[model samples]
Target: MSSPVNIPFLSFISLDREAKTPIYLQLAQQLINAIQRGYLVPGAKMPGSRKLSELLSLHRKTVIAAYEDLHHQGWIAIEPNKGAFVMDNKTKMVERPYDALVSLGNYPTQTGYSFKQSNLLDNPFEESNCTYQWNDGLPDVRLTQFNQLSGLYSASLKRKGTAKKMSNNQASIYFKEQLSNYLNSSRGLHISKDNLLITRSTEMSLYIISQLIISAGDVVIVGELGLFTANMIFQSAKANLQTIPVDGQGIDVDALELKLTSTKIKAVYITPHHHYPTTVTLSAKRRVKLLQLAQEYGFVIIEDDYDYDFQYEKSTIMPLASADLNGMVIYTGTFGKSLAPSFSTGFVVAPKNLISEMQKYLGLLDRHGDVIMQQVLGEMIAEGDIHRHLKKSLKVYMERRDNCCELIAKHLGERVKFNKPSGGLGLWLNWQAPISLLQMAKFCTQKGLFIPKNILYQNRNFTAIRLGFGHLTMEEMEKSLEIMGEYLSSLP
Candidate 1:
């Protein structure tokens, strides 16, 4: 038999009596580690239980238990008198240094293999620790009625029928039916549960749709100033993106019509209810013209009415999908936009055939959907909690919108120009002064405000900003805008 290898076992085999793990199991694991690392070679004689116990200052019975565990696990063998021996692993040991062997247990910082990367799909959102922040039109989560939602969710959990159905991995059929009815009543979307596919977010809906429609090098059109994340998705799918002009009345239908005469366009993406970054609603005439053009040109229209629920002006305009008789439109929006951050709950409204196909792709992407969250939201709709919540929240948001517009007009004076958007949570500010937006963002950051770069649109022709006021209180909005005004005043 080979002699026991001279390894400093104390260097690596550490024990903590305070830890929840029992001492015997920890010792057994550490011994296995030593054997695998070649510090204890095959056929080597291990120190006797009593001898090792004295060397390590542990009870003999603890060492004996560890040895018995190793023996049962096949890592070692024990004889009546010879004691424990390391078992042969059938492979030659490399016998690396102690420090090198310890380092090898750590995870690699980067991949060892090469792969493709797409700069087009890089994340544009940034994280910061600043005192204040801005986003591109998101609802204020603080205003959400979370207590009511939590009660609803708790009730759902206690229901035996829901628990049994969920255990079998069934989709939330009730939520789909309730959501479909809500959309039909609110958005004028003529659809049933079969025409809907619930998604984690509108971004996920856009991605799944892009994959099904856009082939490599296919022509996809958008406004010259479009939603940045949506553009990234289309480009990542290898679509040849083309941009038409957007003005005060939304996307220039004439420019789009002119482009259609020459190119075989695959689809056109729009935030028609309130154009992203600009907040201009597509005019009634343009809506009719655009629908006519879609039929004539045979292209898909992706309408993202993200903030349709928060309109403060005269009754909100119905989405284009409401009047989509020929089924040329695919409408997407969030169902829980007014609720707390727990649910992102986005739904896509399309023809039943297309929805059936999208469901397959959705299954591949999000195999296990959030059934519990859906159940809670469905309950909210059924009990009219959603309608009540929106009605109560709308008044508060309207006040904030009015206060934000007044502050901008009063403090900034002639330095900035904007329209009080009729519906969405944000206002589009067109900077009139000659100031670099990047430099202004840096200046704001210095004064404890974090203006995300994605919200700032700057190029040679124009400098614009989409300042979201919905997420901030009146006091916060005042402070943020004051800092912004101070920076603009100091600029030449």
Candidate 2:
């Protein structure tokens, strides 16, 4: 056998005593790296542990443990009288030349192969470490009843028969049954477990629906000012998107009707409870007209009632899905906006046949459904915890909405035009003053408040923003609004 390469172990193999990794493990990993990188070739003898430890200023036992580890992992071999030797790993590759600048552990920056890219699916979520931030109508996660939820989750884990249920890949049937009853009582949705497909988010539900129903070049329709994320999902699925006008009431059914006469549409995605960004409730007349058109034209209506629970008014309209008689509507929405985001559940209420098809796609995406969370949610719905939570949260959110509107009106004044929406976490402010929305966002960020670009809608026709106040406290809201007010007033 050839002697060990005269390569200096100290030159390439480094040890950081202060690192969290154990010294022995770190030494072993570095030795493995040296072997894989051809600094130490196969069948080369290793120096005795005592000599190596003395050279590296480590205890001899530490060096012995590292060698033992390498031997256990089959990277090296040891015999009674003989020392360790590098084993042939059998991975064929050209020996890489040593470079001082090269790092053995650095991950590759790009893929070796080409991939299809869709600009439409570009990330709308921005990363920010700022203390103050705005979002597109999200719940205040701090208000979640985590103690009760965690207790329920913990109890479920210790239950007698939970292991049997978790061993299988099937979704939580008991939870679905409970959720089905909850929807019937709350949303007027006459759905059963067979008609429901649980998902992590409304976006995931929409993606599954798009994959199952939409083909390349299929026509999908939305309002002129629609949900940006939903439009991204449709366009990414290769749908030919057609937009109709949205007025104070909602999407123009008359325009939709005219378009239906000339072209065939596969689906119409609408947030009718309170139209996204603009926050306008669909008129009852238009809702009926839209449903009638769906039945007449054989098109699907994807009704997203994202914030149905927080409506402050005495009178509220049931979702378009409630009145859907011919199976023309595919209703999807979140169940627990009052709870923390991790506890929120998304459900789709459609005909049983359609739901069955969606299940196959869901299985492919999420093989292991979160059964514990489902159990907790199911118990919450059945035990009236969800109802009480929603009732309590609605009062708080209503007050926030009122306070937010008052601030906007007092601070923004005549510079902006807006209507206090009946229900929703956000206020849509149309900036009448001549100022760039992008510039306002940048200025706000400089002042330690981050405003995401997705919430800023600017064009030649109108400049507006969807300001979310649900996550902020009364004090935070006041301070944030004051900052925004100052920025607008200071601008020419």
Q: How many backbone clashes are present in model 1?
A: 0
Candidate 1 ranges with C-alpha deviation above 4 Å: 1-68, 79-83, 92-99, 167-171
| Clash pairs, model 2 backbone | none
Instruction: Give candidate 2 regions above 4 Å deviation.
Output: 1-5, 8-11, 54-56, 79-83, 88-101, 116-118, 127-131, 168-171
The worst-scoring run of ten residues by lDDT in candidate 2 lies at 93-102
Candidate 1 structure quality by residue, lDDT tens digits, 349-415:
9999999999999999996688888888888888898899998888889999999999998778887
lDDT of 2 at 78: 95
Q: What RMSD does model 1 have?
A: 3.1
Candidate 2 on 138-213: residue-level lDDT in tens? 8898888888889989998898878887876333888899999988887887888899999999999999999989
